[model samples]
Target: AQSVTQLDSHVSVSEGTPVLLRCNYSSSYSPSLFWYVQHPNKGLQLLLKYTSAATLVKGINGFEAEFKKSETSFHLTKPSAHMSDAAEYFCVVSLLTGTASKLTFGTGTRLQVTL
Candidate 1:
């Protein structure tokens, strides 16, 4: 089984400041990891993905995450925060089960950007 844990349920940051959202994962087999963002009533958007290609993956809007196999972590970071960045972020783990792919989602981290 695969699972993900988002360390923070809520993260607050001032506009133009740095942002960090921590995540840890576990899987018996090699896992495909992804970060997704949802703004207000909008649909989830893919931020980035790690599929054993690179340890460091960059995403949209200047966001990035590093896959650390040793620590079992894939934490998201951004040098600066924007008001548009305020939303719900999810840490996901994907696995191929039979002929289908199953995705496991974290509880999620709600990002709040302040002025």
Candidate 2:
């Protein structure tokens, strides 16, 4: 079984500031982790992903996450925050079950960006 936990329910930041969103996971086997962002009325966008490849993964809009197997964590970070970055972020953990993988989404963290 695999599960994800978003440590923060809400995060507020000013424009140009660094952003950090914490996440932790538990899995019985090697897992695939992902960070997704969703705007108020839009579809989910992949921020970054950690499969079996690199430990540090980078994605769109200068976002990145490091898969830490020792800590069971995959935390998301951005060098600078933009107003457009204000959205809900979800940390997801997925594992192979039979012939397919099943995803389990974490409780989302809502980011509030201010000018």
Best by lDDT: 1
lDDT of 2 by residue, 1-115 (tens): 7899999999999999999999999998888999999998899998888998999999999999999999999999999999999999999998787998787999999999999
Residue 51, model 2: Cα distance from true site in angstroms = 0.7
Each prediction's TM-score versus the true structure = 0.98, 0.96
lDDT of 2 at 63: 95
Q: lDDT tens string, model 1, 4-102?
A: 999999999999999999999999987899999989889999999999998999999999999999999999999999999999999999989899988
Question: Which segments of candidate 2 are over 4 A away from where they belong?
Answer: none
- The TM-score of predicted model 1 comes to 0.98
lDDT of each: 0.97, 0.94
Model 2 lDDT, full chain set: 0.94
TM-score, predicted candidate 2 vs. hidden true structure: 0.96
